[model samples]
Target: MSDKLPQNRNNEEVDLLVLFDYFGKSINRVINFFYKIIKGIFSFFIYALKPFIRNFKLIASVVLVSAILGFIIQKTQRDVYTSQMLVKPYFDSKYQLVTNIKYYNALINEKDYAQLQEIFNISEEDTKQIISFDIHSGPENENDKIVQYDEFLKSIDSSRAKNISFKEFVENRSIYSGDVFQIEVFSHKKDIFRSLEEGLNTTFTNTYSVKKMQKRDSLISIERQNILSSIKQVDSLQKVYIDVMNDEANSNKGSYTTKDGMSFIQERTKTKEYELLKESMQLRQALSELDAQKVEEDVYFDTLSSFQDTGEKYTSIWRVYTLIFPLAAFVTLCFVFTGKNIIRFIVNYEA
Candidate 1:
């Protein structure tokens, strides 16, 4: 039994050694597999980069010439001095304003100075200096969902909106309400930009009001007139009540017993004056709000963000080219060189 035990122990040791050896070999295989993958990746990059490195002189020459041309062009370009008015225009769709800009631009490009002056009130010289009239908006792009501006919009809808149903209005509501928008103008001539800004603002202010807003404006006007008329009528009635009280007092507010024992002045005019005064006060209160409401025939813009001369202008033009040119040149070189190499290799293989 002892001898058999020794033999079994030796066999167990041999099995343990074999197991360890197998596990070690498995780990080595896994590590080698990953190493080869990484090595192959580095080798591929090295091979691909070698040809580009060999042609460094050519690539450098092309890049240098492109950079020099870009610099020359940038220098020759006139520095566009600009003025801007960041006004929030009143319009249903911002695109409407954008379309208007394009139309006005077309008018300018056509050299219709008379037409431009009539429409936008800008002079021929102003139109010539004006580079662009543009509109911009937030990231809530054309297709983006427009979340409600909150319950304020809903309440406004309930109060004034009529052309669209409340349900349709709520359903169709987008982030953009015409109450606020941006108007941007770009031009080289500072004087022209300044005058054109005011001209365009006035021109836009006279544009047609939306149907619902027009309806609301008419209603307000009617209501205001009605309130004023009622105030006049109520004042007259109040004066009559006061006159009756005065006459009664003049006759000696003294009560006398009749044969029927009913007092005439006291019974008739007792609460009448008080009631008339109370009602007149209420009508005046209602009429006060009507007077306070400033109604207009057309919707207009309020400049929420003011125009700063510096905010409108971009930084050094060279700075823009700094980031832009190198990347552009690199991409162009890669395309040309790679294509040239591919065509050359194919031609050689064919030969």
Candidate 2:
């Protein structure tokens, strides 16, 4: 029995060993398959490079042609010149003390659209060409302030005026606000500066007129309020006096001797009431006059603000073209180079 037990144990051990060898062989097969796949991919790359390796002359010719094309593209394309203008924007010192002065001034006294178009040498329809009028306030850092100022300057129009492009408007839009306001202008050439300068000057001068109109409007509003308050007070006084006279007349209606004193009191009250009523009427008239003045002032202010805004926008319009043209040129060059290289590579490989 013991001998048979030993023989059975040895047989079980041999069987376990055989199973382990079969599992190892399966793993080896998978590794060999992956290694062959890796070798095949490496061989494909080597095969692909065979053309470039076998034809050194062709490769050199292609490189030379690409370099020459790149040089020509770099040279023949016109360099986009950028000119910048700086501006400082100023708010009227009395802007806070006086409300809507700038707004009203622009509305009331500025030239009409036709006159502005003639002055700027532009058609009224061209006004829409103006894009941005960004106002920046109080940058803490000097460099940042200058950068902001430059950005503001770039926001104005840069179209041609009287056969010249408008680059001068940037410097012309400068406002004095003790480090607070700045304007910058950008253009392709310096020659446009004079025309831009003139346009900006005219536009800003008109803007000042709008500010004045706004101030007038503010004053009118104050006057209107004062007149309204006075009218209300006079009306209240008249009502009080009338009420007192009515009470006196009612209390002494049937009393014989006492009626004389009551009549005298009522008479005095009636006269005072009439005087108050007349004063109230005068206040109302004054209020009406103030209202008319306010209307006029408002109209003037609106016109001025609109004109100034339009002029500012007109000066800023050129930045768009300035930004777009260079970028477009760069993109065109990139596309040309990439397309040429790709087509050359494909044709050569196919051949």
Candidate 3:
């Protein structure tokens, strides 16, 4: 048994050596594969740079001429000015407001200066200066978002509400979901914004919004009449309860003896006048709230902030073509060289 043990140990050592050799070869192959990928990427980058390196002078001249042309255009174009107004619309008038803003943009695009003149009540020359109109939701804090989310949850089905989280609700909400909106107008004339406000003001009172407002007022009137009637009934019941108690006190009879000579204890009656009073107070409070709501939202829309008399000069990064032209020229040259090389490769290729 001792003699066989050494031979067995030698065979085990040989097997381990073979396994280690196989693993080392596999690791070497993986390393070689990654190395080849890195080398090929570096070679391709150098090849791409060769054309730009060889034709540096020509590329520089083209880029310089394009930059000069862009600078000239930038200097010659008319300057733009922009102004903003904030508004809170009631009775879903925001829908009409957004629609009107789009209509204004369309009119501007179509260059219907005559129609624009009628709408804004401005001269044809002033209307020609108008560039664009835009509207988007105004700023709101987290608490406002939470309140809106709660309302949205209540407005939908309970099963669907369970699948929606607060973050999801906020992310999915549209511009019309907001209660306030900011209207922006762009024009070449700095003072043109103030004149556009009158036209914008007319946008919030469409036929739909008018009917909705009337319906709300009618409902409030009905509710007010019902609450007043309830208060009157409660008052009458209270008066009857008071009279009954007063009469009982004056009777001076705690217990009465029957003809059988059996004396019975008198059981005083209980009145829920206190509960009735609480109900009356609650009803009155609800009625007051309804009146307050109607008073606050009577108008079609409220202007939180009006447009400035003179708009500020507007600038955009996209308008800075002095720097843009040179970059664009470089990219265009790269594409041209790449195409030339491909065509040459195809012509010289031997299938």
Candidate 4:
């Protein structure tokens, strides 16, 4: 048995040694693999940079010339002025507003100065100065986003709504999801924006929006009539209860037993005046709200802020051609050098 024990211990020691050897080899292999990847990447970058280094002077000259040309072009370009208007559309007028803004842009692109002249009531010369029109969702705070998310959840299936988080909902919402919008007009003439407003004002009154407003007004009228009828009924019941109480107070009968057809039970159940009064107040309040709603949203849209009389000069980083040209030149040179080298390699190949 002792001999067998020594032999078993020797076998276990050999197995452990073999396993250690296998693990050591794997670790070395992994380290070599990573080292080779890093070396290959470093060599590739050096090879790619060699062409730029060899033609440094030529590249510098071309970039400098391009930058100078771009600077001159930028200086010669006319200045653009921009102004913004904020509006809150009712009765789904925002859809028409966005659509009309796009139409205006299309007209500008087509250079239909005649149609533009009629739209803005501006002269041909003024219409020529018009550049572009843009619209986007206006500013909103965190509370507004949360309210919108809550409304969206209510509008969808409960099971689907459970899967949608507030962050996801906000990220997925489109421009039309917003209640307010900002309309921007770009033009060469600084004072052109204010004139465009009269045209934009006309955009909010589309056939669909007009019909929607009419439908809303009709619904409100019906609701108001129903609430008025309920109020009248409540007042009549209240008057009857008051008269019954007054008759009971004035009478001085000792028995005071009320007869219901033949039998007398001597039970006097009072009217629920408090509950009726509460219901009457609620109905009247609802009527007031309906009237207020009609008064508030009488128009298709409300102009939260109008365009400025004179627009401010518009500037953008993309318009900085001095920087743009040099970058473009460098990238073009890189592509050219790469293509030349590839063609040379293909021609000189011995396969």
Candidate 5:
């Protein structure tokens, strides 16, 4: 048994040695295969870049010429500056405020100077070169009903737009409370920018916004009358009931009974009358509060943020060169080299 044990141990060692030697050979084969692939890739890149390297001087000449040309052209362009103002739209007329931008834009486009002057109180000179008047709004809470509807339509059609046509986008959506919106005025001159901003504020107040507020006032007045009428009718009905109860008690001469349809002292009838009176008073209070609000909120143009446009800096010569020089130079170099090579290719093929 001892002899057999020694022979078995020797066989196991030989098997282990054979396994390790096979693994080493397999690993060497994989390394050599990957090394050959890397060497081929490196050679391909070197050959592909040979043309660009050979024509380096000519490409450099092209880059210099193109960079200089770009610098000059960009320098000649006008620097347009934009002035922005922020305001919170009126709660009730928020939808109208956005819709009216389209109406205002039409006046600007038509060159109806007389009406524009009256609405905005701007001079003829101030209107010159007033590039555009625009309104921009940020993303509001998704929970807002108007925003939800807007999102839904945009999801379905992908083009829910506003202030672009006579049929305003707001006509389809709800209005939220005092949504903050931005007003931008673009112009070539800073003076015109300031003038346009002031005039826009005036136009919003006197023209579009005032008309909406007046309409709202008319609606509130109608509601007030309805509520008052309701209160008066309720009071009249209560008075008749009390009168009937009193007459029945008097006629019975202190012998009130359920059999005769009269309760002792008629407490339940008084309680019901009291409830009606309480409801009427509440309606009156609501009307009064609404009137007070109209007084305060009748006017428009609640400017939330007002800051003068920080004047734009004219493009410096070096700054302009820095922005355009490198990019123009690189693209021009690539194009010139590639184009030359393409022409050479066609000529060789013809030959």
Candidate 6:
């Protein structure tokens, strides 16, 4: 039995050995297959990259040429824009009144040629010079007038009129219900900014004045209603007192002596009430007068607020544009270059 057991153990050991050898062979076959596949792919990429690697100088020259062409094209065709400005009047907050946004928008859309010409200080003869008006609206008598105005804008000897529209030049283009205004002037020549600044300042000053007057008229109407309400209340109280006195006098019936004293008291009371009523009526009239003065003061305050808000908005909007445009251009350029270089490197490495 011991000998038989030893033989059995030997057989079992042989079977175990056979199983281990089979697994080792399988593993070796898999590893060799993968290794060969990786080597083939690597060789293929090396073969493809051999041409570009051999011509590093030529590739560098091509890239340099492309960059130079891009720079030159950008520099030569640069749009030389000249801008001039016209400022819309802001809403007057001191008067607690704001311009209707829809009305303001419509006013902007309707391009007032006459007003624009006046603001730009363009003369009729100068209007014949170099202006081209592209009216978005249908043809109207104003089209010719606008064309004339355009010519005048172009005729200005200052660089402000060159290669830019009055509309394009203004930095702030927002229309707000509350006090806010802006004007932008652009020109290829830096010299034109001074002239545009002076002209726009004057024009905006006049516009603010006119808008103030209109707001003043509206506020006056409100004050007038308040005064009228006070007057009506006084009149109503006076009527009630008068009716009470009449009813009391009609109810009283007695000897002349008895009635005399009561009549005196009643007369005294009625006189006092009448005097009070008269004073209140006078106060209403006085308020009406005061409203007139307040209207003028409101007009002044509204004009000042309009000017200040307009100046602030102009500064803020222009500052944003100055930062945004350059930053956007720079980021766009970086994205383009990084994407191109990364793709090129990846393809070359793979090849």
TM-score of each: 0.65, 0.32, 0.86, 0.85, 0.55, 0.30
* Best prediction by TM-score: 3
What are the per-residue Cα lDDT tens digits for candidate 3 across 1-351? Answer: 999999999999999999999999999999999999999999999988899899999999999998998899899999999999999999999999999899989999999999889988989999999999999999899999999999999999999999999999889899988999999999999998889899889999889999999999999999999999998999999899888888777775868899999998777678888998899899899989999999999999999999999999999987888888888998999999999989998999999
Worst window of 10 by summed lDDT in candidate 2: 301-310
How does residue 319 of candidate 1 score in lDDT? 47
Per-residue lDDT tens digits for candidate 6, residues 65-155, read 5556555655464233333332324333312212322322343356444544454465433322212211111122545445644765766
Off by over 4 Å in 5: 1-14, 29-67, 87-128, 131-134, 138-180, 197-219, 233-281, 292-321, 335-351
Candidate 2 wrongly placed segments (more than 4 Å): 83-351
Compared with the true structure, what per-residue lDDT tens digits does model 1 show for residues 126-180?
Answer: 6676666666543344233233334435666555644555457546665344345
lDDT of 3 at 159: 100
Ranking, lDDT, top scorer first: 3, 4, 5, 1, 2, 6
Give lDDT per model, in order. 0.64, 0.50, 0.93, 0.92, 0.67, 0.50
Ranking by TM-score: 3, 4, 1, 5, 2, 6
Taking all chains together, the TM-score of candidate 6 against the true structure is: 0.30
Per lDDT, the best of the predicted structures is 3
Candidate 5 lDDT, 285-336, residue by residue in tens: 9888878988867667577777375635334455476456767677766676
lDDT of model 3, residue 122 = 88
Lowest lDDT block of 10, candidate 3: 246-255
Q: lDDT tens string, model 2, 1-351?
A: 999999999999999999999999999999999999999999978855565566557556655555566556655643232222333322343233123223323422453445444555655554322222223332345565455456555665544233322344333444332334222332223233344344544333346657776777788778888888887788777777778777876776434445456432324333476677778888888878877765544432121111111122123323344444445554555465557657878889953
lDDT of 4 by residue, 179-200 (tens): 9999998999999888888988
User: At residue 119, what lDDT does model 3 achieve?
Assistant: 88
The 10 consecutive residues of candidate 4 with the worst lDDT sum are 254-263
